[model samples]
Target: MSLQVPRNGKVCVIGSGVAGLTFSYLLNQLRPDVHIDIYEKQERSGGWLNSHHREVNGSKVMLERGPRTLRGKSDGSIVMIDIMRRLGQLSQVQYVGKKSQANRQFLLNGQGRLVEVPKNWTQFAKFVMDPISGGLVRGMAHDLLHCKRLDRKTYEDESVGQLLARRFGSTEIGDRIISGIYHGIYAGDMNEMSSLHTGRRFVEDEMKYGSFVRGMFSGLGAKPSEILSGELMEYNRSIGGQTQHNWTEFARRVKQSAMLGFAGGLEQYPLALRAYLEKQQQVRLRLGQAVASVLPGTGQNVVVNGVHYDHVRSTLNPSAMAAIFPEIQGLQHGDFKSVSVYIMNVYVPGTNLIRDAIAGFGYLVPQRSSQGDGLLGVIFDSVVERNYLNWQTQLPRHQDDCTKMTLMVGGHYLNKGLHLDLHKCLGHVSNHLGVDLAAYNPVTQNLLARDGIPVFDVGFDKKAARVVEECTRLYAGHVTLGGVGFARGPGVPDVVMHELAAVLHA
Candidate 1:
């Protein structure tokens, strides 16, 4: 479907998350004549990009209740870097140091002890032989040699758990490793989340190339970089980043290791974008203003908050988006699977608790393990970015080595309705990591995010496609829906790329 760009028409964009903001930025750059007005329900922008930085007593601490890091080593990540440069915020990007321990992450074994996850061949062998691994190595061997592909045709989907158990010859491996990764990102149950969403590219390789092991080498066939380069050029032009692009710069940026974040935190991006957009005469930001309803007319005109616009773009979640436009049909609640999550922030005055405990980027607890408080994972913020703890304005001697951590709670565990109190969470941390909270006089904050993350349940792709199609058919040339949740994958960079492509192509 071809979308006709209006010469000088007004457009209303719902939701002020990264998707909406990036789309607005690109649309404004691509067609400066088009008047853009963004309406955000929240008093502040950055939906899940929440970052809290403050000083308590003499210590500086930062609490990232939402997204914390931006990956800088992939094609999607390069899209974000290009956008940052275009916005003149490239200098603000800070990469994790080359030799930093932040590059490492741990996993909780069945014994409730944190163990460094394998990194290289030697580590992998040791990890496999370890008694704590619980036969995962054997499972991998069976999967690599004997497992056959499922009989599903194109467009058919299966749960991550189903796919793993069928191909890997054991449900234990899925519960241990696969579940932890998905839980960390999507806060989803492997038994329900779609394999298509989690590992679609790899699974597609196995279908055609015979095995996932072989697919890793020959998956993209030949000249895969050629396919990626063409897309990158188109995206670069769409965002006004490069008039004449250099493949060398793109390759260098994509190879850069470590994740990047702003000094203030991830929210800096949206906050800066908001500051930038406020100066534009053609852009209007309506903060704290909710779109009461969306009334689509026969043609290209759509009514939002009693104002008529040529086109409306929705960045809201599936259910919330559907609720606003009651006139549309064929949309249902089951079309989207969103999971609620709770974040507990903790700051201890001394590093004894963290240093003496698990090292690296903290650990993830699998569902099969019995870690009290229903903890999913823990991020060692202080270890990840030690500089965040060193405040410039503070007195020199005031800089004390402190441990700051963000503990993730709930997800599928929310169904249990366990005690989510700060005290209880602290106890869980103490028990799991053997950290003495009382010694450090810990400060804590609880953030409850209801329907915070979108889960890619089985057949989610089909449902997502239907939702988009329904919106198009019901409100042709009137409403365009786009966001991270609707992207092919749910990484921050993935969402940015998806929105950029969708909005530009639209």
Candidate 2:
């Protein structure tokens, strides 16, 4: 929630990345009189939303080097849409239809073969016969018919794997689908990630209604924004003072789409934020400036790089936070491990690389088989995105319709030593795409982001709370942490929600 500035407030925001920029923008809105400064070590404002444009074989293609799209029906997404519409860029909103071919999802089984996670009758028939679906039907049946609902009061936190085993009454579902889904989303082990932090409703469904399928009919559903704080809701209302579009209703409509993004790319959000925030008279963006420390000031203020401010909000990860404040390292009670990701975006002009042209969103490799070959997932970029960043002035759709995919490699599997075997990784990708690496020549860009995605391990919520408590004490209540690997989730929407809460709380 951006606040109405009470007076001449000064706040220093660390990291001009998504979280930082978001925090500044919200705070500026709520407290217009407050002078805000954003410090980013990198020259760019957006954190992992790099959209690179290139002309490949006479066709213009936009390659998203990082996160390309946002999930629909999220609290953060609604807020994001409101911000986008207010930015006067609502015309740029692009939606992939709910009935789009991109709605189909795949999972790589233990045999390392991609199979459609059945949706329609034909695919369901094939899935029933596939080895990957060996005991899935029985497991689902057990969940719907045999499993007994746990008392809501007696329920405790458990890994998603444990939930599947207990609720579904089989391990095959976990092995075949759960593992692949979590690996794609978290780049972490399904057996290790917490069910509550990842999907509380999923766990609660089995606890309260005996089964997930049954819970859909239980009439206890909640909207994504229903859980948001009243402060945030008020902030939304404040922002919506005179706008015609009801963003909540708009977001509900958007939730019907398979996915959504800007016509240019996800980077459009942050870059646009940078440009607009720069225009604000009360805002100052300190790009390319590294913060040495954020120490408590003499009286009623925080000092960031020798400048005293009423507040200093940091948007860096845990390790980055610990770097500037070593005292925070003592608060760690459990692992907050993060994984590095090696992203390879490929643009194969005029030639469809996927065998049989099996068009779907993408497939994810399960954690059980991801160690030696850590290809977390592949994005069918072209299936979801049909236009380049400058599509307004770019080549025709057919000319840009070549294979566009992104290979995300080296997460939990290779996070140990942080190694990058580009050729080896590309070989795995090309193999999945039904091509020989030696013969395939595609325009590609490789990017390695160290400790990019955080693993939401079991008990991560408790451990993160303790860390937050300790950090609050260390900073003498002058600093706050609002970034990935904290209490909030690691998704783009989560980051936005976290900062909105921070702004309201402060």
- The alpha-carbon lDDT assigned to residue 29 of candidate 1 equals 76
**Candidate 2 on 22-118: residue-level lDDT in tens?**
8888887767888998988888879877888887666567889888887766667767766887788776776665566777788776676778886
Per-model lDDT: 0.73, 0.73
Candidate 1 lDDT tens digits, 1-506:
44445789898989899888977887887778989999998899988899987788875677899878876565666776666666778656666643457777787777767777876668778777654577586775776787455454743788888877876678888777667877787877888888888878657766765456556556334532423455567776665455453645554544454666766788887887788889999999999999998897656788888898988888876756667887666455556657788888888765546764466767887777646567788888777765322122221122357777888888877855666555766677777677667667788888888887787789877787877787777777578777866776777777777777766575
Alpha-carbon error at 32 in model 2, in Å? 1.1
**Number of the top-ranking candidate, with TM-score as the measure:** 1
- Please provide TM-scores, in order, for all candidate models, with all chains considered together: 0.90, 0.87
- Taking all chains together, the TM-score of candidate 1 against the true structure is 0.90
